[model samples]
Target: MTLLLPPTSEVPVPKFNMADLTARLLAPGKPQEAQQQSSPALNPPDAPEAHEEVRERRRAYQRPAGHPSRQERAQARALAQQYRDYAEAWYQALRAWDMREVKIPYSFHYEPGESDLDFLTLGSNVRTPTRYLQTPAGEFTEGEVGVVITTMSRAPLVEQMQLGKMLDKLRHTPDTTPVSLLREDGRWHQNRERVARYAVAVLTLAVQLRDEGAEGPLRYAKAVLAGAH
Candidate 1:
């Protein structure tokens, strides 16, 4: 026997459009606006421009290369003045130590016409004066002497002779005066190591003098020598 079925209008039919689904799948994807809103911007509107940033860096680099400021110049002048004052103090201390300035006749063999002759003769005997600070301990000379030759009274004979030979090897003009050992030219002398040794010798003498009841100038000299570097 056949069974009775319900009316087609009463049963709702579901619709499936293949063409619309295919079109939607094949269409290009729209920009992900939500993802863009979540991430940070590469160049924010409030940030400085690239050229402006470059200019700022350039200015910072050039600041050091420009002329010194007023404060810097003032500081440099003050430092130079201090050095001069210290040098004068050191000289005064040496004077107080009974240091007598003496000139020794230094003769050397030079070419006949290399310098003006002391005597009108065709000989290689050239006399250049050597200056020394004759102290009770030893003889002291400047760093320009090119050798650290402090001939102490108690030094060995062999050492004294060697120092004499070294002194003889130095060449100088006949009119050259003794250079001060403590004169600072904003830098160390040519022979920095030798100059330092000379300073040490001076400091040692100053220390000895201080021990012998001479405390005032020697103390200042010691301070200057200690900070000479």
Candidate 2:
């Protein structure tokens, strides 16, 4: 049997660095420029020398070395959950849905001598080679192909809120987004792709189990993904 995923014991907790974010947030706020100007003894905030000194001071900021803070950990958890939801939505309406066989809702028959009305009378069956394709078991029966899932349909309300916020931000500025902004806003960066793939694997298993297509294939996928046989 082909394995779908590595064993759970083999899967370690995924790590991503949010240290830059923690540093910025925990850093001191901007100086009160308007108030600072009132003091004649203080150097002009915009002066190159003062700017250089401030920049050097800011660069010295360092976060404690160890596990992330409670806030940072929560941020990571929320980010992961959001990514999983996005992955689920992505696969639901993918090409597999397009390949499902179409079923006519109403039946119709040709009148009296309709032999001449057949869609095609002189057509020959085509024998195309399918050597490279893997055949899936069972024939497709038309049923729920075009389902319009409404609000809060695929996931919980909170998850929908998360997904909504995420998509909105993506619509505005997808490019030129930096890593720190991603961590602060809980958006996914190019980090830890295995978790997204793991989400896909789990969703595929769920689909197979739901359709009950074939127990043999489902068991193999489940065993590999869930570390159970």
Give stretches of model 2 more than 4 Å off. Answer: 1-97, 100-105, 108-145, 148-156, 160-190, 193-209, 212-229
Global lDDT of model 1: 0.41
Each candidate structure's TM-score, on Cα atoms with residue i matched to residue i, is 0.23, 0.21
**Candidate 1 lDDT, 26-55, residue by residue in tens:** 446643532222222222223346435434
The per-model lDDT (C-alpha) reads 0.41, 0.37
**Per-residue alpha-carbon lDDT of candidate 2 for residues 66-158, written as tens digits (9 for 90 to 100):** 547678899867755454444333333231233433333333455767666666432334333221211133233222211112221344676
Question: 192 in model 1: Cα distance from truth in Å?
Answer: 1.0
How many clashes does each candidate structure show, in the order listed?
0, 0
Instruction: Please state the error at residue 108 of candidate 1 in Å.
Output: 52
Q: Which sections of candidate 1 miss by over 4 Å? A: 1-152, 155-178, 182-184, 211-229
| Error at 132, model 2, angstroms | 22
| Candidate 2 RMSD to the correct structure | 23.9
